[model samples]
Target: MTIKLIAIGKTDDKELVKLIENYQKRLSHYIQFEFEIIPDLKKAKNLSESQQKQKEGDLILGKLNPSDVLILLDENGKQFDSVAFSQYLQKHMNSGIKQLVFVIGGPYGFSEDVYSRANGKLSLSKMTFSHQMIRLFAIEQLYRAFTILRNEPYHHR
Candidate 1:
């Protein structure tokens, strides 16, 4: 199965981009991984929070295929330790799905429609994180998960 990460906006920090790129390269060894960045909305200051989320949600939904399993990285979603997260990845891989899509929404978070269409939600931590930072975290975790699944030395107990 292909694992795709869709995040709003680009990473402006060169260091963070390098780190994300490193993990992306590492992740390519295990499974098909795609990282897509939805461009930041223009004139965002002119729109209300709800409108921004709605616009972002529309772009997110547009990237998805009908059979893709949508999972949102949300503050209120379920939390898992590293081992459990590896198991979660294994579970999805075993399920025979075409693509597993995880989304990191914009500053306002996901819209009602986005939430409604999601198969599940996941939280990396209870505390909030910047959207750009979360992109790095998510990609790193995905690479870590695959390494753990392969019994590699990358992850220590």
Candidate 2:
């Protein structure tokens, strides 16, 4: 199964960009992976928080195919340890899904439309994090999950 991570906005920090890329490269060795970025909306300053989320949601939904299993990274979503996450991934792969899509919403979170369309949600932590940082964290965790699955030394129980 292919894993695709879709996030809104660009990461201006070169260090974060490099680290995210590193993890993405490592992940490719395990399964087909994609990192797609939806450019930040223009004239966002004039829109309210809800309006912004709606516009961002539209863009996000536009990138998905009907067969893609959508998972949203949300604060209220289910939380799992590295090992459990790996098992979750294995379950999806075992189900023979063509593509598993995970999305990181823009500021102010996801719109109702986006939430309704998601198959599930995942939370990295209860603590809040910047979108850029979340990108790196999510990617690293994905890489770590794969390593754990293969019994690599990367994760120590």
Candidate 3:
């Protein structure tokens, strides 16, 4: 199965970009991983929170294939430990899905339509994080999960 991460906006911090890219490269050894960034909305200051979410949601939904399983990285979503997350990924792979898509929404979060389309929601932490940092965390967790599954030292290290 292919694992795809879709997030809004680009990462401007060079350090964060390098870290995220490092994990992305490591992920290639285990699975097909795709990181897609949707450009931030133009004139966002002029739009209401709901309007921005609606627009971002449209672009997010547009990136999916009919068979993709959508998972939102939501603040109120389920939380799992590293080992458990690896098991969760194993479960999906065993189920024979085509693509597993995880989305990190814009500042206003996901729209009603986006929520309705999601197969599940996962939270990395209870505290909030910046979008750019979350991208790195998510990618690193994915890498760590794969390592755990392989009985590698990285997980314990």
Candidate 4:
């Protein structure tokens, strides 16, 4: 199955971009991975938080295919340790799906519409993280999950 990560806005920090790229390269060895950045909304300052989320949600939804399995990285979602997360990845891979899509929403988080359409929600941590930082964290974890599944030395229990 192809794994795709869709995040709102671009990473302005060069260092973070490099780190994300490194993990992306490593992930390519195990599975098909795609990273897509939805452009930041123009005149966002003029919109209310809810409105922004709606707009971002629309853009996110537009990128998804009907067959894609959608998962949202949300603060209130189920939390799993690395080993469990690896199992989660394995479960999806074994399901014979075409694509697994995980989305990192904008500042205000996902809209009601987005939440309604999601197949599942996952939390990386209870602690809050910047959207840009979360992109890096998600990719690294995905890479680690694949390595663990393959019994590679990259992930230490």
Model 3 weakest lDDT span, ten residues long: 148-157
Clashes of each: 0, 0, 0, 0
Q: Give the per-residue lDDT of model 3 (tens digit) for 1-157.
A: 9999999999999999999999999999999999999999999999999999999999999999989999999999999999999999999999999999999999999999999999999999999999999999999999999999999999987
Considering every candidate listed, which one attains the maximal TM-score? 3
How well does each candidate superpose onto the true structure, as a TM-score? 0.98, 0.98, 0.99, 0.98
lDDT order, best first, reads: 3, 4, 1, 2
**lDDT (10s digit) by residue, model 2, range 104-142:** 999899999999999999999999999999999999999
Q: Local error of candidate 3 at 58, Å?
A: 0.2
Worst 10 residues of 4 by lDDT: 148-157
Identify the runs in model 3 with alpha carbons over 4 angstroms from their true place. none
Task: Report the lDDT tens digits of candidate 1 across residue range 58-130.
Answer: 9999999999999999999999998899999999999999999999999999999999999999999999999
C-alpha lDDT (0 to 100) for residue 63 of candidate 1: 99
Candidate 1: C-alpha RMSD to true structure equals 0.8
Model 4, position 128: C-alpha lDDT score: 100
Error of 2 at 139 (Å): 0.5
Off by over 4 Å in 4: none
Better of 2 and 3 by TM-score: 3
Clashes of 1: 0
